[model samples]
Target: MPSTDFQESSSSPSSFNLSILSRRRDQVHSMDSPPLESNGQQSDLEAFQRTVAERFQDLAAAPSEELLSIPWIRKLLDTFLCVHEEFRLIVFNHKSSLAKPPMDKYITDFFERSVKALDVCNAIRDGIEQIRHWQKQLEIVLCALDNQRSIGEGQFRRAKKALIDLTIAMLDERDSNTTVSHRNRSFGRQSNSRAEPRSMANFRSLSWSVSRTWSAARQLQAISSNLAPPRGNEISATNGLNVGVFTMSYVLLFVMWALVAAIPCQDRGLPTHLFTRQFAWAAPIGSLYERIMEESKRRDRRNTCGLMREIYEIEKCVRLMNELTDCVEFPLTEERERQVKQRVQEIGKIYEAIKEGLDPLERLVREVFRRIVRSRTEGLDSIARANLQD
Candidate 1:
């Protein structure tokens, strides 16, 4: 179980960092200047902040048991999509400001971060494909042992072979030197030679799939680099739009970091420090991050392929079934038969969970990939148009 501290912090709104709010208020009162933007613009910026905070708060408040489950990850992606659309509208309303000095710099930086995220999306899709392979092995095991008239030597042999193959595949994934990405084909490409040219062109346009040596940790670090909040003067100069850009940048970094933590990807490493406490949304996001870190550090999960709860359950089921098979005798005693049946039941439950969850989860990931691509193209075009008007 994750530490109880996260649950405690998330349950109460007062647990959020209030010092930042107080400090901002003090700074405002001390300034000789008037309000930074008109009341209307200020309202829009405040609404954006509130929406981000509310969405993350709901995510943080999830029961501990559901924290890293498939459904939870889907919810996380859904939150990102909603916030991203709102951010897009914010940018559209103030598109003219995007091409001006510091604002231009911020938007450019964000677009670059989005490009890096494209690679992360590709890596995550590969991880999903790897899980599907594991599922196939699970199915084989189920076929051998499930719905049998009576347990027999031949069935045990088949189950044992499937289990061994599954173990080998998982171990290979844990070895940092080996990764699914090495053999990964792009999501945009077809295997057919006739479609190769067009598919290759589309693949290149969506960001080329990451190479064998590319590290997810390094890519995340690149996104996080120099991602500082806008200064008060810059915020004022941009009519509060700089705050929106900063918010989206932080959101982008955190979402990508969480996806890597939850999915099996090449060279996965969690950044030690990723969030600041100054933002309204930071409290909940930080708590979720800490809890996930705690999960990864657990004794049994330390070297697993991924921190996803379904993966953990699968690993557990495999270990138990393997042990039961090893010690069982032919013409099994009633007690031994009972144990085998019990373990089979457990496996059946996990198998169903994976079957129901994986497809929806993959669809959500695909949607995320498309959303990022679309958002980047539209934002860049908007900025280009704004630049032309100048």
Candidate 2:
């Protein structure tokens, strides 16, 4: 092609592609060159391009910090935190892909925030476990306390009944049969008993009362050992809830944790699964809360029956306890003073047993409490030191 030919074609640059046929064809295209875009489809396309340019200009001019503060824009940051740590890392790939520095400020910010979020999540998890441990312990303790209380009440009843029965027997001696009338009646004389009294005047009656008391106690223990608890999840669960620890955990984990770990997860992988699985575990925190309420009703039913059995056992024990309180020096009527001395010895033996058993339980509880306290105290101390350093 001639130099003139190239110049003619270049004159209509928009139509230069069609110059394959003729140079004169290019001149004709120049004469018919489209006017600067105004109305119709051409203008609409031009306007769209201008709008795109303006958007880019505005984006460049905007302050990054202020832009990030936008509710719509801040959503991106929220997504970063709520996501699983692994998911976020994989999706964004850190700053390793950077040209030279390989350390992205944005990526580092995400790392720090994610770690903080995970820490918060862990704190929330531990808080829940602590609450659970305490609550379960509370159940066992309350049950034991209730058992102890039953024992106390039963003792009181036995003491009163014994007083009444003894008084009745002592007063109603005249209504006895021939054997009692012969054994203790003073041969129609008003002398002190040469033989044993009908009630507890001698060795045999005293021994018999002691035997009866022991027998009654054994029977009660047998009954209690066989007694079954209420067979429902209600009382057991509600008792668990009354622990008060669950509520505190709810506030910390659900309300506070949601705020801290609301990062989005766009990737799918094992790490992402771990994040989601961890979050899924949180579902129990919310869902089982309803179960806590249901537990209330169930507990009432089961406990009512259970409580009765426990109370009855305590009653029987208290009765036996009173009978055994003072050893029989043959009989209460014949020698109350001597019997009381023997009872003191028995009580001493029991007190020693109680102390030994209580020691281990007390020590275990103390150890658990100490560990929790130490961990918390150390954490608070570290936080204070960090603030001071800052």
Candidate 3:
């Protein structure tokens, strides 16, 4: 019954536009699910990348006035293990004492801060010691807790033994006392029957009250045994938890320090330009430093290889992402930002991969390092002497 002229044609652009919008929404939803790159691993990588990259840029863009001391909170418990952590502080900590060289990239504060006794490594040294020192302190507290629990247990045992002795004495007293009381009652009953004796009820009631008192004492003892004491096992258990804290904190730091010490690569310093130049000369991978990095990434480690691998993977991804950003002269934009975001995701993936890979590597690295360090030091010293003689 509809008029043909009034009917809107299905082929027209207006009707077709609604179909397109629905399709677009569906497309976005498909991308919205976690990426297969590692669920959200890639995203985490991208986030880390952006943070570091932005910090780098900020440092670069900072005015001479602003660049004096980095505002970043460098509370890296992990950073203390870095090969360059102590060195960088040592180099920068002396900024104020240097000859009138004003071409220094140091924010004036860096030099000013460095003047007091030149203990650039002091902070890192303190941090490392504290991590271990706190561990030892935790161990002491745990020992104290354990000792306290032992004393408490000794007290409980003593109480239980005393209760047993008291119960046995009470039972013996009751048995002998009952015999005596029974005899007396019998005599009294006989005397009462002969005299005015229908009133034995009061004595019988007193006997019942004594029996009830004995039952109550027994119940009280049972309840005391069953109820939990205020500090039973708790102190020891807390001390037990300290064992975990010690292990976790020590293991993480040990793994971190071992990584820095054993690795062939060094941080050199924050002189990115100077390093970049040296790195450029190291090999032609556009950066000589990059080539040494690739070589170092492939090094042999005993058990801790996995840990090293994980660290290296994160390091590699970071290096690559930084390199990409550096080479890109393009202006930052939404699309570029999205690309950066993708890089962050990759970094996250690398982080997880490294973590997953740490345990085996740690064991192997320690064993091998101990042997190598033991044997190589004297030989290396002799070789240096020989080279000097030559």
Candidate 4:
């Protein structure tokens, strides 16, 4: 039951914290008063660190059976969006200082990293569509076998054909490097010919889908490249704002990496070396990463389309059902009939899980995509205004 809404509640503690931060920011901007105390700034930065550490700790503490499941992934996105909102507010409070030398560079770099993540979001949406396609095939199998008084060769043949189609579709997804753009899919609203000529509008137009050769693994590498922690001197110079920027950068990288890990994407790869032990959030993030990587390396999980628990279940049930059908005789013994029903029952359960979870998960991803777009657009605008006033 993780909350999926992107907006923070007005009565929430974070909202109260934001109001306090806003008042502090206003005081610092007053021409009649001296600058705000450094202690106030330090405390704000500390709160941000603690919030991130606590959220990821909760995620990492999930039981092994629940880890990487659909609900778990939804919770992970919820964490990212919450932390991201807090980070966005922190940047707003410090906007006057953002146009300065090193802080400017740090903020600019974080935006660049965020831009890369937009592509990841689009790729993930396509990946979700890919799963939906597989779901349709599962539904076909269910229709062929479910609710029958007694199983027959015709029913078995129909179910087997759907299973075979599902197998081929999944294998093609894992092996094919072709652009998913050909599917004409996107999470964004339909572009209007008369819309404003804004940068974000143009960005949406061009990036509604990934290019033919676009690789999720390579995009992740681009985001992680040169993403080192801010040094002590840099932190001192930026009044610890650099640390926030770096923290958001790493969060962006890790979240996108986890999405690619859980969903089918072009050229999927997990780069384990991107994480570091320097931050409090690192341990939980790293723990989750290791668990997923181990899951990927499992004998049965190898060559699979994704590491999602539902996807794994689907594969297992399909295989068992397929095997049972292949060994069927025209006159099914009572025990053999029971076994077929058991296999069908297993598939039915998985089908129900996918049916219930897939739409909600896709909606969460769409929210993630929209939140990233809105944040980036607002941030870049804020930076431009800051530069102008300076």
Per-model TM-score on C-alpha atoms: 0.86, 0.19, 0.17, 0.82
Which pairs of residues have clashing backbones in candidate 1? none
Ten contiguous residues minimizing lDDT sum, candidate 2 = 264-273
Write model 2 residue lDDT over 1-390, tens digit each, in one string.
111211221222132222111222234346774332223322332232232223222332334223211221233223222222222222222112211121122223222332323333333233223223223322332232222312233443444454344333322221211222222210111223243245433422432212211221122122222222212232122221111121212222222222212111111001011111111122222222222223223433221111111112222333454565444332234255344334334433433333333334233323333433443344334434544555
Q: Report the C-alpha lDDT of model 4 over 1-390, residue by residue, as the tens digit.
A: 012221223332333223223343444456454444376676777788768877887897789788878899999999999999998888777787777887888888888888889899888887777788788888888898788888788877888899988876765665443332222211111122232235433533464377657877778889998999876545556766877788888888989988888887776774456677666666667677777777777888766777889888988988888788788888789999888888888888888888898888888888888888888888878888988998
Q: Which candidate is the best by lDDT?
A: 1
Ranking by lDDT: 1, 4, 3, 2
Between the candidate structures 3 and 4, which one is better when assessed by lDDT?
Answer: 4
Candidate 1 lDDT over 246-275, as tens digits, reads 888989888888888878777777456556
Candidate 2 residues lying further than 4 Å off, grouped into runs, are 1-278, 283-292, 299-365
Assess candidate 1 and give its lDDT: 0.76
Order the candidates by TM-score, highest first.
Answer: 1, 4, 2, 3
Cα lDDT of model 3 by residue, 78-107, tens digit:
222232232223223322221122212221
If both were scored by TM-score, which would come out higher, candidate 2 or candidate 3?
2
- Between prediction 1 and prediction 2, the one with superior lDDT is 1
lDDT of each candidate versus the true structure: 0.76, 0.27, 0.28, 0.74
User: In terms of TM-score, which candidate is strongest?
Assistant: 1
lDDT of 2: 0.27
Residue 264 in candidate 2 has what lDDT? 11
Q: Flag regions of model 4 displaced more than 4 Å.
A: 1-37, 177-208
